[model samples]
Target: MSLAQWHNKRPPAATGLRLDFDDGGSEHVSTTTTSSALSLLSDQLATQFDRYKNEMARMFQDHVRIVDVVDRVDSLLAAGDGEAAPDCQREKEAEASNAARHGAELEERVARLRAEAAAWHPAVKPPCPSL
Candidate 1:
């Protein structure tokens, strides 16, 4: 769904605290005091987390697929059937090459995502006096 629809669909009543920031800007930030608002915020965070997890999984899967394809090709080559050894080797090499490239791309995408996520929200521990 669109973000506008998501933002427009709020709960009937909010029971949580309201937080606002005014930096002398025209934009006004508002939050509700109900659990629903917190829940909504939590859900949004969860969605992002899930997306990250999915990306990671996809990267892993890509690597696994490459390995599986390569292994299949190797198996075919190892069969030693005098008839199609060369053809099998050629086809397997091509498949392996394609899978390797795809896997590399997936890894790069995952790395970029991880870097972006780290920049967005780095892990913190304990309370700091600066805050």
Candidate 2:
């Protein structure tokens, strides 16, 4: 029978009568049977939704903790770099000082050699020959 005929049909006189219908292969439930089924379906859906929401909340908390750890690691690396900068500067300064000291020592040695050579020279030294 068509859906309109079924909808217009009067409720059975008996209190617990079961009415079977065939409405072109589609399900059609009467108000009498739907109340309990709908209630069970709503309860099941609510429980599943709550579980899904809780799982998503846990995953979000884990992501937040991971981000916090990454931020701390990055800050530590930055602090290490900051600390290394002064050590590098000190090393460069020490190298420069050593180079300057070595240059002064070499100059003094050359001056002393020149003085020694002058003292050992004869009263009159021979002039340089033509190339």
The top-ranked prediction according to TM-score is: 2
Which residue runs does candidate 1 get wrong by more than 4 Å?
Answer: 1-81, 122-131
Expressed as tens digits, the lDDT of each residue in 67-86 for candidate 2 is: 99999999998989988899
The number of the candidate with the highest lDDT is: 2
What lDDT does model 1 reach? 0.79
Clashing pairs in 1: 14-34, 15-33, 15-34, 16-33, 16-34, 17-33
lDDT of 2: 0.84
Q: Please give the distance, in angstroms, between residue 103's alpha carbon in candidate 1 and its true position after superposition.
A: 1.5
On a 0 to 1 TM-score scale, where does candidate 1 land against the true structure? 0.30
